[model samples]
Target: MEMSREKVAVVTGANKGLGYEIVKALCRKTTASYLTARNEEKGRRRSRTARTRPQAEIPSAGHPPKVYQTDQTLIVNFFSLVDFCETISPLMRNGGCIVNVSSSSGHLSRIPSQRLRERLKDENLSLDELKVLMQGYLLAVKHSRDVEDGWGESPYVVSKVGVNAYTFILHRRLAPRDIRVNCVHPGYIRTDMTKGEGNVLPEQGADVVVQVALSDSRGQYVWHNGTPVPWCGDDPRIWIDGKV
Candidate 1:
């Protein structure tokens, strides 16, 4: 992997909250930084607030969206992050870093099933396999069997867990390129997800993101305070506050 010193970073879901703050901070430190929000108009507005807003494509964490939206959460939270990484990786003028905004709700214990947790934590897990697993979940959802099938009622939580798992797979895949891929739980920020109720501020969460972007680390799972945490199975109480 040919590493370059140029500070080029890409942040998704940056239309508001922590993602927005991360892009803002990166602009001050990096030669080039881009903010991508799914809403084009919203992305443009956020970009204008940054010192070096560079135009680029955009991409969310989650909420218990409408019934139809549960599936969309998985698409945006898990698949979009992976797709965006694949799309932008080759275009990186300088070796880059991918920071996925995950949540404590993603912790393995939140899964509640040993079988599913084991499969998710499989070291040999592939992106295709993960997709298949998620497809099954969606199917179960469509049939109103996801809960009985042990996939859990909250698609939002399952989606982030998928992101955590993908973080590991992506880290290994991108290692050869020296382009780090890491996931961070930005604590419970006062974002829309929390309905403006949270212990951590938006910028405090963004601090973790900015640190990871500038570091040499690869494929790490961390908390908002920069503390390293296990990305896989462990005590749920260790991270999850009370489930999202």
Candidate 2:
């Protein structure tokens, strides 16, 4: 696999908050950057604020401009990731990396069912199987049985969990191509997603994500301060009081 002289990056949900910061951080190093957001206007405005030359400002199609809705969360957080990987991975030069922004809430301990946790932890889990799991979560939500079915009440949590799990599978598949993939819990930062209630600032969190994106680590779930957290193990309490 040959590496490219010019680096490129793409960030999703980058109109504001952590995503915006991530784009800013990447712009400092990458020769080209592309960002996508649910709100086209805000995305363009924020891109100007970042003062980075974005190659494209893609708008998420069919994604309602809402937060935390189960179906929408899955679409924005998980399925959109799938779409990006399939579309961009082939274009990425060797030695490039993909960072999936996840949250500590994605920890397997957040799931009530041990069986479901074990299934997600399977090293042999395929992309098709992962999609089935996501669909099952949606079905459970439709029936108002998510909690009883072992998934937690937060669609955000389930979506991030899916992101973490998918990171592992993607790393395995992309290894031969010399393209690294990792998921990051960018610390509980003061963002709209957190209702502005977090100890770390978005720029601080973005630094960590940028560090991981340029590192050689593959398929690991990392904390905002650059520590690796077990995606399948119990919660490491990294988010308590926004402590790194």
Candidate 3:
């Protein structure tokens, strides 16, 4: 995949933090990228109005000037991803990549509450049903900003777990189509998400994304940088012994 031709990519929650940094890296490595933030107005306000901001110029500094309105719910996230795939996938270059920026907080082990565990494990539930259930989860988070409530530390963390599950689902959905879909736990990067408290820098976290995007591997779940993030339970690996 050479750099000149149009190569479209999408990064959700990208107006700031790791998502923004991932877009910055993708822009430099690819031809074009759709940076999706829940707040499109904020995206537009913060992004340069020059009609063309160099990919390298992303992550300049400070909060993005524009913020668009979006529902901070699991349903919205899933629909947006599906809509982007349906609308944009056709125009992308052959080696285009989809990087779902997730976090370690999404793990089942991270959710200590048995009730939450039972809810997430109900496989008979459809995606739509899961989305509905997820609302309750988000509400729980809002009620208690503390992890002790079984909501993790933040709503974003819970959503990322959904994103990780979505990544696996997308990998299956796109596998036969030959499009690459993968997720990465970019680590706790020092950014707005962690309020700049993380030890890792955004650029450092981005290194993991670059590795996944550049590698021939497809439909894989990798953790910080290029290491394979172990699959939970009986879910089979996206890749065969060594191949996808």
Candidate 4:
């Protein structure tokens, strides 16, 4: 693939871990890159180590509303992503790409209800419908009825699922403009978020993410090694010791 010096990329949560490595990797390919983090000082400190100068330091409102902590996960993982896409996509130049950093937990199989899975994967599923589904999930959580509703117990997992589902929705919306949008599972990486208990390194995970970000593939849920993983149905890859 040809690297473009004129291309610009932006990474969020880039103070440390996978997002930080993604910034470093993008610097090697794109001329301008920007990073956002909850902590201003840490984001500035990390940007100084990159090969290219950061275009800007974006400070994110790190904390969610004082509602249920589970709601916080949904806000950060799903809602914020939707907001970011809606806000930045129109400004992006044609042919620009958007890669949503997702997890294996985002796979459709993770949701127990086959009906719910089908609902999320429907091509006709609109952004408004997605919002309603997400709100329904939050309501389920509030009432301690998530599992019974087939949404599962882990808010993190459900949030990632939402991210993956929204990727397809956004991809369809942006296709006419030649803007490719996809999500990827960056493998289980040893990062601060995981308490350093993962098999893959942050740099290794970021490499796959950067690859997808610069590729022509659209509406794909890629595995860490650059393979496209099915969003629905059984994943053929064996899970050894809970690691893919």
Compare the candidates by lDDT and give the number of the best one: 4
Give the per-residue lDDT digits (tens) of candidate 3, residues 1-244: 6567644566666666666677777767764767776667756644443233223323345542111111343445544665665576676665566766666655444555667666665544445665665666655555553366575554554566666655666666667767788777776788754556797887788889867876766766676747775545322223322311
Better candidate number, 1 or 4, judged by lDDT: 4
Count backbone overlaps in model 4.
0
Candidate 1 collision pairs = none
Tell me each candidate's RMSD, in Å, in order: 4.8, 4.9, 8.3, 5.2
List ranges where model 2 is wrong by over 4 Å: 1-4, 51-68, 238-244
TM-scores of the candidates in the order shown: 0.84, 0.85, 0.62, 0.88
lDDT of candidate 4 at residue 191, scale 0 to 100: 70
Which residue pairs clash in candidate 4? none
**What tens digits encode model 4's per-residue C-alpha lDDT throughout 149-211?**
998778888899999999999999999999999999998888766666888988899999999
CA lDDT of every candidate: 0.77, 0.82, 0.60, 0.85
Q: Compared with the true structure, what per-residue lDDT tens digits does model 2 show for residues 116-198?
A: 99999999999999999999999888888999999978888899899988889999999998889999888888865555678
In terms of TM-score, which candidate is strongest? Answer: 4
Estimate the TM-score for candidate 1: 0.84
Candidate 2: minimum summed lDDT over ten consecutive residues — where? Answer: 52-61
Candidate 3 local accuracy as lDDT? 0.60
lDDT of 1 by residue, 1-244 (tens): 9766666666788877788778777776754777787789978977886643333332234444345777788888888877887787787643577788888877777776779989999989998998898888888888888888887889888899999888888888878878788888888888776666788878788888888878877878877668777766564444444433
Ranking by TM-score: 4, 2, 1, 3
RMSD of 3: 8.3
